[model samples]
Target: WSPYKLLTVFTFIFQTASKDGEVRLVGGQSSHEGRVEIYYGGQWGTVCDDNWDISDAKVVCRSLGYSDAVTVLLKAAYGAGSGPIMMDEVACTGNEASLMFCRSNGWRRNDCHHSEDAGVICKPNEDESGSEVEGTTHVLDRSMDFAESLKNLYETRQFCDFNISVKTNGKESETSIICTHRIILLLNVDANFMVKDGAENFTLTVDEECTPYVDDFIRYLYIKKISVTLKSSKCIHKLASMYGILELQEFCSQLFTQLLPEDLSFQNQLSLYSYALSTQDTMLADSCLQYLAWNCKAFAESEAWYQLTWDQLGNFLFRSDIVVPDEFFLLEALESWILKKGPNSPDLDKALIQMIRFPMMHPEQLFQLQFNFTLYKSHQDLFQMKTLEALEFHTVGFQNLNQYVDLSNIDYMPRIYTSPTWSYLLSGSSIYNQYNPYYRYDYQNFYSQLRSYSSSFHTPKHTSFLFQSDMIQWSFAYYESAQSCRNSGRYCYYDNYPVLLLSFESRPSSNYSIQYQNKALMICKDSYVSDIRDFKNNLVVLPSNDTSSYTFPCSSNFSYQYVVRPLYYSEFQNTQ
Candidate 1:
């Protein structure tokens, strides 16, 4: 026979007859149950579940020193194996000393995949209500003998003939040298070790950054476990990727997927976010972005925030989901980024400046930007136009601006504002009785009273309110009802049931409501939150009155916020 065929035959015989062959459970919840695998042919491999039963499980459990087979688990109950399917159609008579002694299709001769890998759950010795004491003791003794033999073999370096050295480069390079057995290297390391003319020694070079984690990687080859924390996950994953350890890389990916932003410090969060972007780990990157969005003030001062590229900064600002204590912080952060970038590209700067939601800023905030802000002074013409648009949005209510401006503009939309000036109101799902056969006049009211505003209400009843803006007084009424097509002299309505209607009238205290005083005033429907962002069109901005009252259409499961901020418009205009 050829040398390769002879070697295969010798391996088959040794695996079937050698008393020194080892067995272990892997990927189990506990030690007593998992996929059944045997150590032979200088490697570990799974057993096929063909014709596998409790009798076969008994022999496997006896070999492992377990009391008895609790049950035979088939089709890889614990987890699928990744190695070769070594044994198949194992038949045990429940009297064999070991699974090795049982009949099988033969080693490495199975027509099976890892999906068919077998598993077992063995009864613990603690359950001894009525058990065989002497037989169990004998099995335990044999297991101890096998363990002792392996320990002795490992310590004495028996059959070991290869030397492997791992080194990391630095100013003073550190090296780890191992006198390894040929079988250990071939089984644990990689398939490259399976050589015809066995080289006496092998050397591997590692990156200096991965030096600390290299030992842990080496230990995993022997113990099959490694410690991973947020701090070490990156390094260990890097080492695993470098060595093409796909299983270890998969484990690290799972760890990253389960991570939350609060699981790491802010600095570590930023570092991991950058790492996730580089590695294309979208889940982890999104979690970090959520944390950053909520903690806008904290991220604004962070060194990492300053280090973001212009594209990164622009993308972050473009997100409409960013919720801060106030929108002014966003403007300030952008200003800081602009100053850091210098005055090289005015076109790029203009593109980024348009991302600012100037209409969302408080009136006082806009006043400060138009006058006191240095960036605004540097680009007076651009900011002056933006400031004028925001001023128009404040002076003319959104409903009035619908004729002149495209309300679909993102600048006209409001993010979730959680400041004191903004008030949130949610209508319960149970409150609406719309388009129901047995519809009644039943309604639920949500009333929110704040310092600047008295009450915001959601009710089906048609209610009119007479309120004064800090500048002028206005009267408005809004209600929801089921209506059919009708002609009312001026216009015809064709839409059917469930419509919200509003009527507005301006009653100015003075003849000149449009006169620009030192202070500008407008009521903003800050945000309308529903499954769809289109709910924003329903926002009814009620001017500030002594007893300000605002009403919403009584629809199920909807929320909105409105804020009234002090608007300041200066009398002096800076000459460009």
Candidate 2:
């Protein structure tokens, strides 16, 4: 018989195939070592050394249901000298299936029979059982053990009905069956309970009854209550404001560390920072600023620019005690100065000279002083003087000075001839004429009358008293002319003529009566005069029965000689 046949029979008798179809280790061995003969195709052979490591031994041990390999031996460690050795010297690394298939260095050709073989045995350790009793039920607590058991049961989806039996002097005293999905073993006292296959030996007693556990429901209720409270509280605004500026910055830092762009705008960033500042929360503002300073280049630039601008403007506004209104005026003046003096002007002193020479001159003339005292505090004297000097020689004509003058009077024309109301009226008239040209004659007559001096024309005694009655008449005429031109869809041609009238007759307390040709046309206050043309003879009477009448200047040769009647307190109130 062949040596392989003899070895095969021996292996079959010693190691039966496990359910996994592998020869399992049988007794006393913790690892596989020493080449053991294997039977292959009715021949005995040795496995040679090839690729091998502890991992191979591990596979071998686990194949037999042994936990793991503890050791591995290479070469012939068992014995030496044998027959054809089936295959010379036996060499098997721990990784190979058996001694027969391993590669050999002519060692398999040697005639060593009993020496070249591999073997292994089953050797069990306490750890292999996967359990250890750490304490007894008498003096040791079982809470930790029970907790672990509960975790295991929960993970495995096991339903548990624990029956507790209290024994006194080796006799059952009390019994209770508690059904649960999982039990939390608490510390303290002694208790015993029965489970599915084994009675659990518990040493700790649970004083409180187990409550139903619904993780999702509990979490939902908690979150809903918190959300409702937050929604109802006014403090939420402050809290949210705090977090938007403070927490968001911190979160962005860690989240977008590498993705932030390089060329962000400073002005955009200031909007957020300024909001944070306005919240009156110093901590939030400080945090936001710190983050901005660290992460955004634009923020740093904006902060620096703001500091410089504030230092320059703040000194003038606060230190000089310039009133808030004048500060705005000064800014206007500065804009004008910049336009004329050139933005790159080396010295502001010359620029101020130009500012003071024209626009400032009007205010000066009107107020009879170098500065308008009503516009600024007393402490602003020197600063105002410096500003005036800076603007004097920098601007052109009287334009800058007229900007500061209050021109409600036609007699008080600034050299610039530009007044706020007049500027608006002229612009509107220009637009109106672009669409209508029929009013050219009317405009010419009005300009001639405005330029001419007529002592017979009614003029208010007080320059401040605006003429209301004349304004109403002018308004009625302008509205009619504009309507006619616009209806014709042609150029109005009244480029310099006023298209709207400011009514002084509509004053709250003015008790004027409207009449046509010495006959009452409409009662005055709290009533509407729908159409003035409805009156006969086109004559309107005043509140006094003095037969005083006014005529439409446009009726006679398109005349523009209109009167300026004095305004009463009631007239101003009605307009307002």
Which predicted model would earn the best lDDT? 1
lDDT for position 520 in model 2? 17
- In candidate 2, where is summed lDDT lowest over 10 consecutive residues? 546-555
CA lDDT, candidate 1, residue 547: 11
What is candidate 2's local distance difference test score?
0.30
lDDT of every predicted structure (CA atoms): 0.54, 0.30
Predicted candidate 2 versus true structure: per-residue lDDT over 507-570, tens digit per residue? 3343342211111112112111111211112222121111111110111111221222221122
The residue-level lDDT of candidate 1 at 461 comes to 12
- Cα miss at 178, model 1 (Å)? 5.2
Separately for all candidates shown, the number of backbone clashes (residues 3 or more apart, or on different chains) is 0, 60
